[model samples]
Target chain A: MKLLAALLSGVLFGVGLAVSQMTNPAKVQAFLDVAGAWDPSLAFVMAAALVVSSISVVLARRRSQSLLGEPLQIPAAATIDLRLIAGATLFGVGWGLGGLCPGPALAALSTGVPEVWVFTASMLAGMLSYRWIFRVAPIRE
Target chain B: MTEFTPVSATVGGLMVGLSAGLLLLLRGRIAGISGIIGRALSQPLGDGGWRLAFLVGLPIGAAAVSLATGRLVVEVAASTPVLVAAGLLVGFGTQLGDGCTSGHGVCGIARGSKRAIAATLAFMTSGAITVFAVRHLLGASS
Candidate 1:
C-alpha cells in the first residue's frame, strides 16, 4: 500500500512537472532571468503548490502518524547555519547555469535528450562523491 | 522569453502539491527528489522498494504526458561542460544543504521552516545573480 501510494504520488508529481513545462531548462532560466525578458509563469507554479501543500503540512504536523499508520518523517532541523546557506547558494548557481533542478531533470529524462542524460549522470556522480568524501549518510530532509 | 503558461503552470503546481500532500498524508514522506534519490543511493539495502517505485514513476509519468500531449518541449541551453559543472554543483550542494527546490522551496516553505526559507532566499538570490553574470556580463545567449 505504501509503495503504491508513493508510486502514485511520483506519477502525479512528474505529470505536473511536464505539464507546467518546468521540465524545460530554457523556461526555468527565463524565470530566473530577472534582468532579461522575465517569464513569471513559474511563480504561479510555486504559489499554487504552496497553497495546497501548506494545508497538508499543517494537518500532518498535528498528527504523529500518517493516514497509512506510518510515522511522520517531516524534517525537524531548523538551523539556518553556514552549511545551509553555502550549499543552497552553490546549488542556485548550478541551477542558473543549467536551469535543471533535480525533479525537473528526472522528469525530462523521458524526453530522451542527450544533455539530460549527461546532466543526470554527472549529478549522480557528484552526489556519490559527496557521500564518499564526507562518509555521512544523506540527510532525510 | 518563453511563452507565459499561467494556466498550465497553475494546474501543474496544484498537481505537484497534491502529490506532495498525498505522499505526506499516506506515507509520511516528504516529496523531496534530492533527499529521496540521495537516501536511495546511500541506503540501497533496506526499504528500497517504495523509493524505486517512486523514482521509476517519475520518468514514466513524464512519458505518459508526452504521449498524451504529442510533445513535451525541453531545451537545455547549457553545453556539456557547463551541464557537468552545474550537475556537480547541484548534487553536492543539495547534499550539503540537505534539500533542493522541492524539499526546501515547496515542502519546507509549506511547513514554515526557517531553515527552508533562508535556503530558498539564498538560492533564489544566487540564481538571479548567476543568470545576470552568465547572460548579461558574460554575453551568453539565453
Candidate 2:
C-alpha cells in the first residue's frame, strides 16, 4: 500500500510537471531570464502548488504518524548554514545553464532524447561522487 | 519568451501539490526527487522498493501524458558537454543541499522551514545571475 501510494504520487507529480510545460528546458530558461524576456507562467505554478501544499503541511504537522501508520519523516534541519547556501547556489548555476532541475529532468527522460540520458548519467555520477568523497551517509532531509 | 500557460501551469502545480500532500499524509515521506534518488542509490536494498517504484512512475507518467496529448514539449539547447557539466553540478549540489526545487521550493516552503526558504532564495538569485551572465555578458545563445 505504501509503495502504491508513492507510485501514484510520483505519477501525479510527473503529470503536473508535464502539464506545466516545465519539462521543456527552453521554457524553464525563459522563466529564469528575469532581465530578458521572462515567462511568468512558472510563478503561477509555484503559487498554486504552495496554496495546496501549505494546507497539507499544516495538517501533517499535527500528526505523529501518517494515515498508513508510518512515522512522519519531515526534514528536521533548520540552520541557514554555508553548506546549504553553497550547494543551492551551485545547483542554481547548473539550473540556469541547463534549465533542467532533477524532477523535470527525470520526467523529460520520456522524450527519449540522448542528451537527457547523458545528463541523467552525469547527474548520477555526481551524486555518487558526493558519497565517495564524504564517505558518510547523506543526511536525510 | 515562451507562451504563457497560466491555466495549465496552475492545474499542474495543483497536481504536484496534491502528490506531495498525498505522500506526506499517506506514506510519511517527503516527495523530494533528489533525496529519493540519492537514498535509493546508497541505502540498503530492503527499503528501496518504494523509491524505485516512485522513480519508475516518473517516466511512465510522462509517457502516458505524451500518448494521451499527442505532444510533449522539450527542447535542450545546451550542447552535450554543457549538459554534462550542468548535470554534474545539479546532481552534486542537490545532494549536498539535501533537496531540490520540489523538496525545498515546494515542500519545505509550505512547511515554513527557514532553511528551505534560505536555500530557495539563494538558488533563485544565483540562477538569475547565471542567466544574466550567460545571456547578456557571455553572449550565449539560448
Candidate 3:
C-alpha cells in the first residue's frame, strides 16, 4: 500500500512537471533570468503549489498518524547551518546553468535527449561520489 | 517573457500539490525528488522500495503527459560537458544541503520552517545571480 501510494504520487508529480512547463529548460531559465529575458509563468505554478501544500500540511499536522496509520515524518532539524546555505548556493548555480533540477531532469529522461542522458549520468555519479568521498551518511543539516 | 499559460500552470501546480499532499497524508513522507534520490543512493541497505517506485513513475508520468498533450519540453542547448558539470553540482550540492527545489522550496516553505525559508531565499538569490552572470555577462544564448 505504501509503495503503491508513492508510485501514484510520483506519477502525478511528473505529470504536473510536464504540464506546467517545469520540464522546459528555457522556461525555467527564463524564470531565473531576472537580469535577462524574464518569465513569470513559473511563479504562478510555484504559488499554486505552495497554497495547496500549505493547506494539506496544516490539516495533516493536526493528526498524529497519517491516513496509513504511519507517524508523520516532518524534518526535525531547525538549525540554519553553513552546509545548507553553501549547498543551496551551489545547487542554485547548477540550476541556473542548466535550468534543470532533480525532478524536471528525471522527467526529461523520457524525451531520450542526449544532454539529458549526460546530466542524469553525471548526477548519479555525483550522488555516488558523495557517498564515496564522505563515507558518512548524508543527513539534513 | 511572462509566458501566458496561467490556466495550465495552475492546474498542473494543483496536481503537483495534490501529489505532494497525498504523499504526506497517506504515506507520511515528503515528496521531495532530490532527498528521495540522494537517500536511495547513499543508503544501499535502507528502505528504498518506495523511492525506486516513485523514481520509476517519474518518466512514465512524463511520457504519458507528452503523449496526451503533444507538447514536449524544450531541448536544453548546453554542451555535454556543461550538462555533466551542472548535473554534478546539482547532485553534490543537494546532498550537502539536504534538500532541493521540491524539498525546501515547496514542502519546507509550506510548513513555515525558518530554516527552509532561509535556505529558499539563499538558493533563489544565488540562482538569480548565477543567471545574471551566465546569461548577461557571459552572453550565452540557449
DockQ of each: 0.86, 0.84, 0.76
Off by over 4 Å in 1: A137-140
Q: Candidates 1 and 2: which is better by DockQ?
A: 1
Q: Residue-wise lDDT of candidate 2 within B32-83, one digit each (tens)?
A: 8888888887863546388888887787778888998999988888889989
Q: B39-115, model 1: which lDDT tens digit per residue?
A: 88876544737777788778888899999999999898899999999999999989989889899999999999999
Give the range where candidate 1 chain B is weakest over 10 consecutive residues by summed lDDT. B42-51
Ranking of models by DockQ? 1, 2, 3
Error of model 3, residue A1, in angstroms: 2.0
* TM-score for chain B of each model, two decimals: 0.96, 0.95, 0.91
Provide the lDDT at A31 for model 1.
Answer: 93
**Candidate 1 per-residue C-alpha lDDT over A4-90 given as tens digits, one digit per residue, 9 for 90 to 100:** 998999999999999899999998999999999999888999888998999999899899899989999888897789989998999
TM-scores, all models, native as reference: 0.97, 0.97, 0.95
lDDT by residue for model 2 (A1-141), tens: 888998998999999889988888888888889989889888888888888899889899899899999899988888988889898999998898888999888998999988888888888888888888889555757
In model 3, where do residues sit more than 4 Å from their true spots?
Answer: none
lDDT of 3 by residue, A62-96 (tens): 99999988888989789998988998888888888
